[model samples]
Target: MNITVHRPGELSAVDRAAWTALQSRAHLHGSPGLANPFLSPEFTLAIGHERRGVRIAVAREDGEPAGFLPFQRSATGVGRAIGLGISDCQGLVHRPGFDWNARELLRACGLSLWEFDHLVSGQAPFEAHASATFASPVIDLDQGYDTYLRHLRERSPKFIKGTLAKERRLSRDHGAVRYVHDERDPAVLTTLMGWKSAQYRRTGRSDRFAHPWIVRLLRRLFHTRADSFAGVLSVLYAADVPIAAHFGLRSERIHTCWFPAYDPAFAKYSPGLIMHLGMAEGAAADGIAHIDLGRGQKVYKDSLKTRELMVSEGWVALRHPVAFGHRARRAPVRALRNTVQTRPELFEPADKLLKRMGRIRSRGGE
Candidate 1:
């Protein structure tokens, strides 16, 4: 096997096509976990256009393109999955039987360390290196929406009835409730960003949209349309008034849910859940077979998910100062988060503290 690195945009059209072909083949022949929009060339290229230091490592076997790994390198020689925080899934796209050592792969890309969270389950070389594994929830749509609803009813009858009742009530009170599955309005996109920013602050998490590059990336993706990958923005409205919105990426077979937010004033009506149901219905109609909700635990995910996919979170490094330095810097934070995730007793207080901080920050107290 031979490896070569290129700036994402530097890849020739032929090379890009080859990379995309590999992704499609992997998704079809490999596990369903490989069917992530984040693994597409369009996504990596869009991110490359918006951010610096983005690189793609192309691996060839017998002079044919066999794999692609897109990532970013920090000045400190620490490498990370491209669009790590925003990308719900991460992995190297490869044809079946393609194999390479993670350390050698990193060295070929000129990095001492590579870190990733949300590493796709069953990713050959990296899975063994993962320090911890977690279940990434997903809503499977292969059996159609009605079948899924029946399953949901069996699992959470009250949740389904309650959410639907809210939807009916919202429509009865506010006028006709409409759901737009693929909204193209830039203003709606802007509104979703604002809501997400506020939601992040309210939850005591870093506001991703506050970073100009992230904002730019979303804007670019919103306008991006392609067969392999496309940006999808779904919205729910009552009497022509937008109540909830979601912006995610999708391929024909998979929809990866990303940023989702709703108007706080309509929280009582559960517009976000309504919007998601609409997304599932519409996505299924559009030929999507799966909706990956991404890694992390949440009550809504547990209620709606028909199944779960495992993802790994950890770092891989060589024996080097920069690699060790990266480990030392992230270890404490990782330990704290892991501990909180495993212990509900600690999580409740941590969540409360975060919410308090979020409230303070929103009020300009930070």
Candidate 2:
């Protein structure tokens, strides 16, 4: 087995092609964080330039490529996967039955620990799970949107009816129903950034929108046509005005929902929900299978999901005193998150209070 670390220009065309060819059926595997075309050359370059504590490597066994791992090695001997927060998916991309044994992989990568949040199920074994997140909603778009609606009628009657009714009202009251599939309009993107940043601030989280690298990365992703992480910006318009928009990444087949927003002006019409329904319809028409909504179990996600998939996340450690202590403190918090994730009723009070607080903050700002 030959394990080699690769820089942007260092990777041969064949290596790059073979590496990308191995992307799994899952939508997360196609995200720019793991499989983006921009990630190949530019991402490697940026990581080197910024020295944001990360490294890239590809492992090959018997002349057949085996795995690709992206990690950031902290000074204290902790190596974390790159773009964990920003990435909607995590893990090495390799052949079928890749056999991911977390400890062995960590040892191979020469790291003491590997951490992730939005990890794919059954990928790795982790210690000290930080949280259990929501299951992403998806629609299999192999058949036309109408066919999908049929499935929903049999499976999720209430959800389909409610969303469709709201969509009709939105169009009738607002204006004509219109949609811009793959709308690359920069103005819309800018608006979404503003809203997402506001959401971050109102919740007391660090504002990722303010980071120059992230901003540039998002813009870079918008224009990239490479196979790794092709940006898909879908929009819905009413009367020639965009009412709802979704920014996400796609492989040839899978569309992964990342960020979605709608005009507050048409909030009463549930423009975002309508847009999602339309997008789901479109995905089926486009021969796509799953539209990964990312992790989180919101009321909306639960309504849309066909089923649930459990994701495992935590860390493998080199075992330092401070790191051990950090994990210990996080243990209880993670348990709480897991309990809340498994039982929505238990988490509702806190979630509702937080949302209400956020609304109050937004109102105060206004």
Candidate whose lDDT is highest: 1
**Lowest-scoring 10 consecutive residues by lDDT in candidate 2?**
30-39
What C-alpha root-mean-square deviation, in Å, does candidate 2 show against the real structure?
4.0
What tens digits encode model 2's per-residue C-alpha lDDT throughout 1-366? 567765445677787677667653324543323332222433444445544666666777778877777677777667665676676666666665555566666666666667776666545444234355445556566566777678778888887888788878877887889777777788888877776777765654467887887877677667766544467778888887877788777765667778787767777877787888878877776666667776776667766666555545677665567567657876688777778767768777766777777677777874
What's model 1's TM-score? 0.97
User: Which tens-of-lDDT digit does each residue in 273-363 have in candidate 1?
Assistant: 9899999899888888889997888888888899898888888899999999889989889888888987899999999999999999989
Report the poorest 10 consecutive residues by lDDT, candidate 1.
23-32
Give the TM-score (vs. native) of candidate 2. 0.83
Residue ranges of candidate 2 with Cα displaced over 4 Å: 7-10, 24-51, 124-134, 200-207, 320-326, 340-346, 363-366
lDDT of each: 0.89, 0.66
lDDT of 1: 0.89
- Report how far residue 343 has shifted in candidate 2, in Å: 4.2
Best model per TM-score: 1
